[model samples]
Target: MTDTIPNPESEGPSGGWGSVKSIARILGDDKPSPMVLEELARQNKPGGVMCVSCAWPKPANYHPFEFCENGAKATISDLTSARCTPGFWSDHTVQSLRGWKDYDLEQTGRLTHPLRYDEASDRYVEVSWDQAFDDIGQTLKSLPRESVVFYSSGHAGLEASYLYALLARTYGNNNLPQSSNMCHETTSVGLQKVIGSPVGTVVWEDLEKADAFFFFGQNPGSNSPRFLHPLQEAKKRGAKIVTFNPVVEQGLVSFVNPQSPVDMLTGRETQISDEYLQVKAGGDIAAILGLCKVVVEADDAAVSTGAARVLDIAFIDEHTVGLESFIDLVRSTDWSVIEKESGLTETAIRGAGELYIQAERVIGVYGMGLTQHSQGALNVAMVVNLLLLRGNIGREGAGCCPVRGHSNVQGQRTVGIAEKAKLIPMDKLKALFDFDPPTEDGVTIVDAVKGMMSGQIKATISLGGNLVRAVPDQKAMEEAWASQDLTVVVSTKLNRSHLFPGKKAYILPCLSRLERDEQASGPQSVTTEDSFSHISGSVGKRTPASKHLKSELAIVTSIAKATVAPNPKLKWDEWTADYSLVRDLIEATYPDQFGAYNERMFEPSGFYRGNSAHDRVWKTEEKKAVFTTPKQLNALSFDDAEGRLRLITMRSNDQFNTTIYGYSDRFRGIEGTRDVLLMCREDIRSAGLSEGQEVKLVSDFNDGVRRELAGLKVREHNLPRGTIGAYYPEANVLIAIDHHDELSKTPASKAVPVRIEA
Candidate 1:
């Protein structure tokens, strides 16, 4: 039997009954019994807690219904009553289950026991935690420090990340490959170079006060649903919302506030984007430079005509450097190059610039779309450059806002999870943990992949995440994982990565973020940082899916004790007992920002890790926010055969990172399937192809390796000409791991020139 694919809707409100129906479907399907449903409801109620989904800071005055549809799905996904037993694994061989889809694997429910792969039986059998830890410890201890790498997922809490960092450094290995290496490494590198901080300067509340919002490569409706509320509010208050993306996302086009009873009942929708510029894939850098060019030219006219200057001359003179060079580059850039590279007319670019000039305060928001390209760092710098010109930084309702997709990705980085050992000062580790940390830099996700192929990575300890599936070049990633001597995955649910075992592999089931974590002290709370650097405490109410499941803190502590020779001064055991102690230690490590950790942790309003750029306090070497003079925008070349299209990998509404919730993408009108590639009708005709035609896509690579994805159905889309959009992870196979950004090492997943085959 074949699956039926639904047609894409031409128009609809972002969220209303669609969100409600989705919530019902997920929760009802996952937890059928009345008793289970009641328990799930109890877990979702607001009682001074945080949402388990994306890390947008909860307001000081909490609403009873604070969670969004995605949050509900994420929470219920963890609240699932189903459990995978040892008997279940015995019935299915690893090779047999290899045919399962990502959603199918997640639907198998929580991992109920610690299991180790047995070569003789070709199956995973239940094992004691001590036995698993012992094997892992012995293997790790035997290997040279450089041979082992610690890869962390962003799903874990701050406490676990801090402990994991300590464990890695103490074991004399600093090779920590993190999820950030895949997602926002460019944001960190690019923003840090200019503002001395990688994170966004604007707070959550600033959105309400902004006069205009320029969303670049972000769809708040899907990636971060909580943000839609703020955008809706900003729209209601007469703020201009401009969008620049390859695809016209439903969330950015129009939205019906699910929180509003009147809007929900009447189907009254609020138009989101006043201007939607559909830039070509990998064209964001050129588009932003073009906008800067308009602003610079406008400022020049304002100076001559005695009009109010668009550029912030006072702020530029006092708080920035290299403005002249930046303006010169923008001026010298050709109009034809901007138009061709951006896939937008000069009139449109200039019009958006006019909107910027008209507004007193503006916020710039972007996502992975800008940072998943070869020129990702330059793309980020361009956004910063645009905002810097108008004095968007150092003011309320105006700053660069990078929407962090994961719930705790930013928090993990805040609490000592970094590839660079020096990112967390040695003095802090020495004073707090009393250990002389390794000075050598650690490997990132990209580095780990290269290391694995060369047999440099002997063992791997993963905290959470489907690491193999998330990386590009799927076949290569799987082959590399098979070469490891020991691979340990500390996880809650079953994923594709667990099936591909090393010579010795162990699956250590851990408590989900939605489950209550009780320890020696009492119910524990973990902290997470939002995209805007607001830190809040989240405590789950649901009972553990399995009594055998351990908290991440406990898992890390046990591993640290078994592997690293115990130091009386380290206090790993004590830290596990009460997470507040961990927060206290974290505060001790960074006393200035995290002072009074316990008190701040309980703050209903949460604590803000202040940004120097927002306050006009530059920490740069020049003692000011540096105006980066990027090279002039070059005319983009697809360099592919005439009928070829540039493909940009995208996420479905039902997906978050590699976690597939359902088959449908409600926003894009894709239902019941992820096998379709969205293409422009003209491109389809140009290639002499028809809609619903099955074809193979062969990626053009610089490495001379043939990477082809077969059996992809083409569907007509409203995409810009010469570009196509396909679901991520599935399309990730086309991205060559070696084809990555030079500065950030992030795979160029957003831009892949491909030729269609019959």
Candidate 2:
């Protein structure tokens, strides 16, 4: 069970029968019947449940089946008939359940009641909703405002997210950290500083018109299967596609649309990437530096010879600042260093650069691979720098698209989920609520862990997310979490995070995204924002898993009402009765941002909440797009130390963020288990190891910590030299809690220093 099986790798393209089989398996095992197909019809419709899966934008036009294989898995997971009722909780102990794998722990089924950890019996005992809320309020009231951490996740829709943020701010705590703190904080921090926009600028309709795409550090096959359709469509239109990553992903190489009748009938896959460059792990900066070097040098040659200029000279002079420093940095960087650091030959970099400059319009797409690193924010800026060289942003078919992973994470931030006081306008909040909100910066996931370990934070109220499994230094988080005074989780199902019961812990069950959320007003709809900034509405029609479960809006508002002294100005009761009032408050706080919030969210084709950068308007202090100069060239390219190998933690095909759906990784061809290490043949031979050999991986960092992950079986891959890959959550233990980007405070989970063993 511990060792991964060496199943034959899929020779066919991504997403053909494999996807169909997975859909069948998930539906047949978890939810048997064609009823799910009927639900799928209403999945992304104007009045239906939103797929609480990956945040890939729903298409402008709806199809028969609007969801993907993983999306179906997520839906089936929520709508499964199996339930972990009161009897199961009373029978199991937290200490025993902690030993279960993430997959098994979740497969136990949906929680049916609000439960409190009883230390006397060492099991979770069912508690009445009224008593649980009252006891939680008492604990929070006993603690200092600064000592409480209100952590929200992506599962809750916009109304719930907005309420959760308001709850935190009203209680005088600015510590509103969510799942975005792990993934796209770099995108928010990096893109805003450089381009005056925090989100992706490209939409699917416009992206279809692009002449070429430059994909950096994203694996659509595993991370986002829905995105592969666009890549496939673009390829069919004969648009050039180039990819840069340490491993050659199957989806980027070739893909067969499982839904396409012609594809299924012919069994032919459309070629995806015109060119694939195997950049070394943590070497994206060097690769991007090389790209800029090409375009900059080309521009210099054009200027000298009076030939057509490669750089967008007019755009540079008019729209942006810091061009001189950017040019100087690109020109001064050594080609040899770029080639060495990127682990690609100079010829390869030059060829990729040549291809890049030929396209009139391009879409630069990236994902966690770019953001989860030591220089993550800088990594984002570097991509923007390259795009600026060709005037890619604010154009017809070009811009930086940081493909977000978790669902509604961007939407959560759009409403109010932020740590910094400056991000949200406090003056507007004060004007509407008649009460001053907290202005102090809040603790991030990293800081929260440290605070918990030091006994500085006493209480935790989570909307959703598995904190114990998601954070760096897994052992440390598990140990530190239980030291607090109280812990409360608002979720649909049980997760590893629920196991960490402090002095008093309660798991408050909430209605799942697809379940009907009825208030006094009637069944209500919730809103969610996608990766491309499109707002949409979802109305859940399914029956509630349990009558005891409450809506997140009710839970958050009730908690706020009980914990914080009643504010006469804020209508906690009315907001829960009708969500429109909540939207009104949100719009009032930022009138220009979410004006007419209720009317626009449910449009047949969701409206885009436009980014200023898309219109060539800069929101920065300088009122112009700025070029970023990195403090160090090719920083953290991870040049090898004596026994070190650059380790890249990746997600399996059946996994989404911290949630592992199954044991098999269909894309990489590993089955039955996730405990495996994948490295190039050369690395395996050099390390004196063979395929299927069970080996240990010891992380090597200079922080006086050497973390070891054993029971990992070795398997040769086509990955670049000196770099290996392992499944995440398992490998999360190797990352030190302190290893993160200073600007974003995002844990560097993508790349770590490790040494392989025999």
Candidate 3:
């Protein structure tokens, strides 16, 4: 095939120095200085220096080579020199900024001061910190407790997250909606149904020893590049790696290790996966069922032939429940239906099953692609079933691994950040502060958006996210924000959320985690949990951009103090003044894993949390892990109707979640734009379309909600037939709120069926 992929030159500086470095690495002209300087410049942006999440405060003693291309972009974008002062907001009305593209808004600059909407001037005006706090407090106090919602993004530090949760619960409202509700809530919800916990069952070390690794619906190259190292190590160790996704990601196929001097100098890329299976969009369930069916058949064959027993009969008999039912379901599943729905032949399914059976230890890693479908919860249950069938759980090098996005999303959940459920920590709060906490389940992100749209939620306090851009159904969320009684956003940089102004909106400037935070107590070291559930200390190397800027912890504390009278028992002031105290409380709350959080975090390598499943100590009610049998066999699929294709949304290498680092998506040949869509050669021909054709894609869901954009040249990719991919945020306009997993409330951005009009 001709290499017509667009050259990196067409893309802007959005990739910063990392783009040049990646290009050099790709072309075998690897030079480190230029890229390093570019990265340094990117980090030393106006407000603070932003490091890639992976590069941030490593174990103080270890020389870790865990950074990747996407990690560099995340760091560079965080450290950009952009600044959006109150003067800028004063000059530009909410209506004016709303006209700018999402990238333009964020790239404008970091927010320098707290701002509040001025009705007379019809623009955001700078306000005193005290005044901003008072305004927010008064508005919140004026509302019925149930009418206010507190929302969190994944980027916030653990301290900030803990405080945000504390503020909402202390205020007698559990109406907390967070970013997790939009991403892996399905894993939590589904896993909780099967296992007792919501977090992953595997540890990082488990990858090294696993006999086989199953990657389900996860693309690590762009989303979580840090995982590449362990995966590469596993590949080198002869572990059979199987990748199942709707699209074939190049990163999964091969990855070059930049950390190895020899490999970097030689420009040799390591072959990653042993096998790749392109399952249909939302067809993971079907593919998993087919695997289970193969396993059942293999077990039956082994028993009949008196060869070797493929089934872990002893493990199943002693450790699980519902095997008979699961076995029956798998035995009854039709191979023809499984093959048609999963887009995989029975042979391939049987091969994968054989690998699973032969392997002594196995691990299944997944991402949002598995959690954002209509049957997302069920999909997770099916994965557990496969592990259970093999007696994989509660064993070394075996269990489920959900590669979470954002820095501290997992940490937030670990430290009682949920709105609906208060852990034992809340009892301590009651004992300390003497306040009766609300016991009602709080709202989730989806419910918060719905509540605002329905007018039941009158005021919103966004601790750190670009709510409108990050949330699905952009138009509806924008309308909801506009109609809210008050909208308050605490952030470091300018973003799309700043444009969605309420009648009374306030933007509070806060210190980014990379900026040194000092108060009367001392400088603070915040903590974050990695994808592997390792909690480490992150101390800022740079000074805060403005004297007025406070830490998120301080900002949240001030708001709580101003809004609610002091509850002597809880001592919120003590924890807010020093983040370590917050960590102490975290330790107390999760004593099982985080005992002595401060001392443990001081370790340079950081510390791992408890993983019962990894130790084969299942925390299930029966004291054993149970395999689940899904009621259905087929995965979700868009009908093969004329002009319709399955559209999956993806993030560019230059972007992190909703934060766009740059416009270029170098891998798929698209440069300088995220508006383009990828399609198969036959689909392009059948639709009478050519490369660079601008067309409208109307959602097959919600009565054809049409979104128009200019299409770029179509490339013949390894993507499955009738499937298309587009960059998110830009393409988020096409996802309808109604089209999501019913159980998790996660928008099905990965599998929206659409029709293209040229």
**Each candidate's TM vs. the true structure?**
0.96, 0.97, 0.91
| Regions more than 4 Å wrong, model 3 | 1-65, 422-425, 620-623, 635-643, 703-716
lDDT of each: 0.82, 0.84, 0.73
Please provide, for model 2 over 1-758, each residue's C-alpha lDDT reduced to its tens digit, 9 standing for 90 to 100. Answer: 11111223654577888888877777666662346677777887677766888888788677777778778888888888778887996568889998889888778778899999999888899999889989998889888999999998877888988888888988888898888898889999989988899998888776778888999889888777778887877877878888888877887877888778999889887778877888888888989989888888898999999999999989989999998987788888888888888888778788878988999998899988889888999899999988998899998988888888777999998888888888988888888888889889998888898899899998889998888888888888888899889999987788998898999999999997788889999888888888888888888878888888899899998998888888788788999999888888877876776878888988865767788998999887789888988776543535568779888888887878788788767777788899999998898888888999999998787778768899999987888898899989899899888888778888887788888766
Q: Write the per-residue lDDT of candidate 1 for residues 1-758, one digit (tens) a residue.
A: 01111224533657888888878888766773334344334432333345566777676654556677787787778778778888897689999989999999988888899999998888999999889888888888999998888888888888889999889989986787788889888888878888888788888678878999998888877877767888888888999988888887888877888878999889998888888888998788788888898888888888999998889889888888998888887888899988987888998888888888888999999888888777788888888888989899978889999988787888888878888876786787876666788898988888898888889988889999889899988888899998999989998888988988999999999987667889999998887777878777767667787889899989999999989987887888788999998988888787777878777765665788778777878777788888877653521233546666788899888877898999767777788899998898888898888999998998877578888888889888889898898888898889888877768888877778787887
List runs of model 1 lying over 4 Å from the truth.
1-11, 32-48, 632-641
Query: What is the lDDT for 423 in model 2?
Result: 90
TM-score of 3: 0.91
Give model 1's clash tally.
0
Model 3 Cα displacement at 249 (Å)?
A: 1.1
Candidate 2 error regions (>4 Å): 1-8, 32-34, 635-639
The global Cα lDDT (0 to 1) of model 3 is: 0.73
For residues 516-585, write the lDDT of model 3, one tens digit per residue. 7886688887777766667777667565667778888888888998988676755667877778888877
Candidate number with the higher TM-score (1 or 2): 2
RMSD to native for every prediction? 3.5, 3.1, 4.6
| RMSD in Å for model 2 | 3.1
Which of the two, 1 or 2, has more lDDT? 2
